[model samples]
Target: MQTKTRRSMIIIAIANGLLLFGYGLSLPFFTIYLISQRGLTSSMAGLVIALAGLSRCVSSGISGELADVFGRKTVMVWGLFSQIVAMFALGLCIELKVQVGWMLACYFLTTFLGAFFRPASNAWVTDNTTPKERVEAFGIIRIGLNIGWALGPAAGGFLVRYSYSMAFFFTALLYAVTILYLNRQVQDNHTPCKSRKPSFVSALLSLKDSRLAKICFYVVVITAVNSQLVVGLSIHCKQYLHMPEYYIGWFFTINGLVVVFLQYWATRLMAKIRLSTAMFIGCALYAVGFGSVGFFDGFTLIALGVFLAGLGELIVSPGEQTLVSNIASRETRGRYLGMLMVFYNLGSAAGFFGAGLLSDYVAPHYLPGPWLIVGAAALLAGWGFWRMRRSLTDEEDGKTNVPVPIKKDTITLN
Candidate 1:
């Protein structure tokens, strides 16, 4: 049974990798497309992304509760199938040169539907792995995720010179293929919680657990900081640094490579330290990486910045995930993760909008301004995590240090 579960874990990781690959191939180009093709201002584009993120946070948070009652596979299929349609429609919007409003509508749908599969799939992973094993397990998943990240942009860089729409079409194709494999090969490994059904708002109640709430807040801040890479980097390089699209793609590919190679080792290292300590360290690295970008010029320095951020990612991300897994009982795992993702999306929204504001208003007067702001935020989040160390614990060691997580859960709406 252990072996089978392990195999399923790998399979799920592969499917997830395919999804990330599609995203890397196409989604990274979204801001660029919106600006260059559709002619939206930087602030306007950022606003669009922020709103889309709002949609994602709500959908994903709600989807988690849905996953708890419905089977993981059921929710996964629903989200996956729907996302494919949205992707194709998005592609058509791009290909046909549709109105900006239509394009925005499709993109919003795609982002919102994208949230559905994640919590369910992640819950499936939690179901299969022991709390002790979750860091390494999530590390494996991250590896799969970054492999696509590594390759997708390099391929996308080349493909975009020809057609941005093609990248979208390719993304949809990859997702379709993943769905086929899922139906044929994968089983619903997670059994649903039988106790009571839940509503979308129920996941928000989990925030009442102060420790869990802290973790979710950290995710928001970090994810926002990380958004500089996704939402701001392209604009920064193209507009300020004067780097071409392909080079930017290459740099992102390298960043993903860093995560892929180092993630497992980082997870192992994180297991030795308190999860909060690891996150604090990771955030410090993020500050150093992203903050330094503002003070320098040229590809080499920027690449260095991206590399440091990647190092931060490989370290904290798995440990952070393990924390959530450790905090939730098995029955509530899906909802717990779902709630975490809500913050993740919210962070993305904050990042997107914040980056745009910095870029539009600040970058013109001070080239390093946007990146410096990003750097400062990263450091602040690191400090926050360090202080929260007492509230968290190490799962595998079976030790309770401080901030013993409250045993009482918030009531879920029926």
Candidate 2:
């Protein structure tokens, strides 16, 4: 990689690490907080998160267009600044026991603001790296994110012992630290397009491509399955299994370890397979891991499930980014990527909402109901990918004419 490209990747990675540190700290606790402290039912808590997540999808798409218009650094700085204020207010609400509606509004605002960080940063990575370098580039980025994930939850585990509000306060401070560090060391090397502004609706328009749309829909399925990790696990274990808070924090930590240690190698290995095939495999592993967790007892046994899910994430995350990167026109990279994330967040929205309802009405009556339903959805999603492998393989063949700076890796992905 060129030094400048590598430098940008490193900068984005570190920035992502800082950005996600806050997410790791608070997200696992959010569902429980709403239910326990805000006097909401589990379904209501899930509804709030689902609503916020859906809004975030729209904001994420818009952020991409803004990034293309205003530049990556500008959008990121704006998002981070906004997030700091929102998160600080969220902390105060949590600490002060404010009205549920106000507390939720702050949380919703944070989720919307959070949308700004990823598409902009990921687009920055796309701008710097050639197609051949993107999968590993994204892997490098995920490593930094998981590094934050590893530490943040562990720290939040401790903070939650003192006060959950502390996690929100500390996260805001972390975002400030991130902005300060980034401004000093990172430069806005990517230029905004002058030829024409990308339409804000272009992200929506791009979804007309059936292949991309299907994958996006599949993502909704995967996220619905993945939602159980937070929405269901926290409530289930805490209420029934009596799992301690520290163990839940460590669950996230172990998943982060899987990514930090194995993501690069896994990304390379996955690149050797057909993209759709790899996605299918990822979904299978993800489902099996999630399913097994509901039946297990103790932190160690549960960690095994988390470990497997992490491996699934290691493969799937980079593969998704790489597909969008391969298919995107240079000028439209941000919109395409942002479009993919729109579906990504949509999956989270569906997952959170379904998880909430399942946890409330189904899980209590039939403990395995949530996992069984999600596991079924994941397997079905995997089948969708498996069926699409040949078409996806065909699309990939058409995408590779761009001159590669690096030699083709392994079997060239078809």
Candidate 3:
């Protein structure tokens, strides 16, 4: 059973990797494509991207509810199916010279469908793994995610030079492959809750648990800080620092390399450290890295800062995820993860919108605004983690320290 579960995880990771790779390939070029090829303004492009995230925010909660009522596997398969359609629609939109507004609509649909899959995927992992293994499992998944992210953009950039349509076509092909892979390899793990259906109202009511609520809040803040990489740092590089376009891919590559090589060791090290303490350290490093951005003149120095930020990301992310999984009820695990993702999407949208507005109005001073906000947000989150550290230690000692079969058969939802 353990071997089968592990094999399933590997296959899921690969499928997820391909899907993310397709998305990553398009991400760096999407705005550029809008601006250069489509002759749209930067704000318009930002709006389109923001709409995608907004769709995720709205759909995630719904997806979680669906996962609980139906089955995680069913929701996941459906989500992947939607992604395949979305990728194809995106390609068709570009190939047919669709209007920018229509193209944005296609992007929105894609993200909305894609958002439904995450909670199901997360809950599937939680269902299959014991508490001790959850962090490591998530870390392994992150490796696949980052690896795809690392390679996708560079490939996208090369492909874009030939034809913009190729980028979307590539995304479509990869997602189609992902759908087939997932359909064949992944198994359904979703058992219905005691109730026949789980509603959004019930999910909202579950937030009465202060610890759980706080974790979700922190997840939002952390995700907001992450937006620094996509929106904040992008502006900083392009506007303030006047860096070349190719370096954007290089920055992601550096981030992926760090995660690929160091994530396992980092997770092990974090096991020795308190999860809250690890989060605090991660946030501090993130702050320092973002804060130093204004001061760095060379690509090497900036890369160093980006790498340091990635290190901080590595430390906090898995630990935070583990902490959430440890505290959440088994029956509502998908809902919990989905709630966290809602916060994540909210944070991401706000960061991009806020940064876009700040950069637009603030002019030359705009570059620092987003980073400073992110740095401040990280510090605030770190402080919140520090306050919660004692509770975490007590909980870890009492509940999470125990070891069990990697695939614990306790179905809390049932």
Q: Which predicted model would earn the best TM-score? A: 1
Q: What is each predicted model's overall lDDT from 0 to 1?
A: 0.84, 0.80, 0.74
| Candidate 1: tens digits of C-alpha lDDT, residues 1-414 | 267666777788888888888888999888988888888899999999999999999898878898889888888888989999999999999999998899899999999999998888888888777766677788888888889899999899888889999999999999999899789877876777677777666677778778789888888888898888887888888877787789889878988999889887887787677777888899989888988887777888889999999898887677667778778876688889899888989999999998889889999999888888888888888887787766655442223323334444445546
Scored by lDDT, the top model is 1
Residue pair clashes in candidate 2: none
Q: Please give the lDDT score for candidate 1.
A: 0.84
Instruction: Estimate the TM-score for candidate 1.
Output: 0.95
- Residues 189-265 of candidate 2 have per-residue lDDT tens digits of 77777765657655677776676777778877887777677777777787768877878888889988999999878
Candidate with better TM-score, 1 vs 2? 1
lDDT comparison, 1 vs 2, better candidate: 1
- Comparing candidate 1 with candidate 3, which one achieves the higher TM-score? 1
Candidates sorted on lDDT, descending = 1, 2, 3
Off by over 4 Å in 1: 1-5, 394-413
